[model samples]
Target: MTAEEFEKEAFALRPELKALASRWLGTPDDAEDMVQDAMLKLWAMCADLRSPIAPLARVLVRNICVDHMRRHHYTLSIDTTDVPDLSHGAADAECIDRMMAVVDSLPTAQQIVLRLRHIDGMSMADIAKLTGGTEVSVRKVLSRARKAVREQYLHKM
Candidate 1:
């Protein structure tokens, strides 16, 4: 990507990238720093990057967050509270909360893949790209997560 294109993409994606970084790191300032770091890394490799900036930025931001966590000796725990409201009525809220708890009990990888696929409505390929895994692997993870949630939820219900 050219400098001008990179600049435009970076500007446009700032909010989204920052939000993703904040979500991963749990602080807006840290999120901003990470986004800038990702952007700098992207700028360094702008000439070699062939894909669209969005995917590349996402992958970089995720990597930066992981690196930050590792450096700070922080355990990686995905917040499951962002689960979308699938409840149609007051009675369904309890069910939704129960399901979310089940989801929370899942492995971190399972939680991430499940939320990205079902809650965030991301595509398998996109999840694979973001998570640095194969689409087949993502599919398998999602399948296992769903099955686990189903089995556990049935017991709870």
Candidate 2:
């Protein structure tokens, strides 16, 4: 892709890429950094990239976020502390906490897939690309994760 084409295709998706990073990293500031980093990397290899930069850019951003998490020893975390007070008739914090516990107890792949699908609202194909798994495998993992969380949460109650 030419530099102009790369800029149009890749830069147009900046907000989306940043949002993905924010969901993965848990902070918009860090998300911006990761997105910028990914953009630079993409720019370097822009000539080899194809059109519809969405898929490749998403995967690149995911990889960069994962690397950052690994280096910082971060796992997907749900900050229950910020959950609205249930006493005010907001969302059920206890239930959310219980579900989070169940999710955290799952295997790493399961947790990642579950959160990416349910929590981040990512599509199966996008999740597959980000996680380096086939869409069918991602669906299976997500199904199992959901089943496990439901069973475990009910058992706990």
Candidate 3:
């Protein structure tokens, strides 16, 4: 695809990709940075891929996220102080926000797989392809992430 065509298609998919990145990164700034990097990489290889924004583009985005994690090592963390009394209506949102924070704390690979699978509604096969990992690896990461997130949720509860 030419640059113009690639730009158009990428624009259409930007929202979904941005949301995916934000969920994985836990911060809007980092998500935007990752998305920009992905776009640059996609533009560089625009001629090689076919039109309509190929799956490889998504994979590129995923890879960029993984690279960011590697470049800046992220340690898992959660702040459980002041659980915000779930009796209130806003508690649900607060609880989910805390849970998402915990999710963001996961190791990069596991975080990516988990968010892509659960939050982004991506399949195991798709995540595997995007991450260039085996299906078993994806499942294991997903399982480990879920276990950690579950532990946090239960603790908060």
Candidate 4:
């Protein structure tokens, strides 16, 4: 289809797609923006899209909303400058070394899961996909790894 025809077809599905995006993102403006972006992408790929446009548009807009959500996902930030120093020195380094050893002692899957989550800074969803497991399973592996390390650290102390 031509750019004009693609835009027209995409426009017909805009309200529905926009509402879906709004429900996910909790803002009409962002929802509209996502819909507009999906349209532009579809326009670029219009000639290549032989399938019906409505379902494609709906999936594209929803995926856009999900990507937006992921990009804006909240994460806890640590600022040591705001924390009172409690003499974190050689003792802390030793503790971190012990913890690393403990993590190394864990089962391979748990170790990989823990490293992927904290060291490589991958999201649980991503780790799960990489490890061929569900998100819950990945969480379980990470939890077990942490539990092992904590247990070893506590016992050492």
Candidate 5:
């Protein structure tokens, strides 16, 4: 693609790229950085692009976001302490604690998949590549994890 065409395509997909980055990075600042880095790389290779740009842009954003998360050790840290005293018709603090405990009790794979899919808002394809699993496997794991979380935790609350 020509430089102008690549620029236009990149501009068109910038919002999507930012959204994907936001999902993977968790924080807005990190998401901005990921999007900027991905765009910079795409710009550098604009002259060599020979295929449709949207998927390539998404792939680039996903890879960069995963790399950033790995390099920075950005993983979810579940904290189950400090349950509030919701005795007088307030929110169910004890229920939240129970839910967290149930989530903690799940297998590591299930927990990771749940966090990456729900907490991080990543797509199944991206999660599959990130975890080195097949897309079907990722979907199954996510579905199982969600079911377990709902059945074991949210159902009680």
Candidate 6:
């Protein structure tokens, strides 16, 4: 693909990429930075790109987000001291804590896939290529991951 085409497609997918990044990275700033880095990498490799670029872009974004998360050393530590008590009540707080715990419990691969597809808004085809899996496999992984999260975390709430 041409640089122009790559840029256009990357721009089109930016929002989705950012959303995925946000979920994986847990912050908007990190997500944007990861997406930018992914775009830069994609742009630099534009010459070798295939016709359908969406999957490639998604994979690139996923890789970048994972890299950022690893580099930053994000763990399951939940220090709630900084957060102020809200008027919404104790149930909301408990729910949030439970959800975080569930997210923390997920396997790394499932977490990454869930974030990229649900949070990042990436297409399954793109997720498959990014993760080096088939489309059907990616969908199955996502479905299983979602089911696990819902059953283990959300269902209890």
Q: Best candidate, TM-score-wise? A: 2
Candidate 4 lDDT tens digits, 1-157: 8767776777677888888888878889999999899888988888997646888888898899889888999344676554334385557777678779888888999999999999999999999899999999999889988888767766765
TM-score head-to-head 2 vs 6, winner: 2
* Candidate 4, number of clashes: 0
Better of 3 and 6 by lDDT: 3
lDDT by residue (13-105, candidate 5, tens digit) is: 888888888888777888888889988998898888965788888998899988887898876986645434457786577676786788888
lDDT minimum window of 10 residues, candidate 1: 81-90
Model 6 residue 75 CA deviation in Å: 0.5
Considering TM-score, where higher is better, how would the candidates rank from best to worst?
2, 5, 1, 3, 6, 4
- Summarize candidate 6's per-residue lDDT along 18-134 as a digit string, tens digits: 898888878899889888888888778889986677787678878887777788786878876644455757677676788778977889888889889977999999999899999
In the range 7-59, model 3's lDDT, one tens digit per residue, is 78998888878887887778888988888888888888888878767466677
Off by over 4 Å in 5: 79-157
Assess each prediction's global lDDT (C-alpha) against the native.
0.90, 0.89, 0.82, 0.83, 0.83, 0.81
Task: Please list the residue runs of candidate 2 whose C-alpha ends up more than 4 Å from where it truly belongs after superposition.
Answer: 76-157
- Per-residue lDDT of candidate 1, residues 11-119 (tens digit): 9999999999989999999999999999999999999876578998999999999999999998767776644445555467677788899999999999999999989
Which stretches of candidate 3 lie above 4 Å from their native place? Answer: 78-157
Question: How much does candidate 6 score in TM-score?
Answer: 0.48
Candidate order by lDDT, decreasing, is 1, 2, 4, 5, 3, 6
The pairs that clash in candidate 1 are none
Q: How many collisions per candidate?
A: 0, 0, 0, 0, 0, 2
TM-score of predicted structure 3 = 0.49
Query: What shift in Å separates residue 132 of candidate 2 from its native position after superposition?
Result: 28
Name the lDDT of candidate 3.
Answer: 0.82
Q: What does the lDDT come to for candidate 4?
A: 0.83
Tens-digit per-residue lDDT, 112-148, candidate 2: 9999988899999999999898999999999999888
| Model 1, runs deviating above 4 Å | 76-157
Clashes of 1: 0
**TM-score of each model, paired residue for residue:** 0.49, 0.52, 0.49, 0.47, 0.50, 0.48
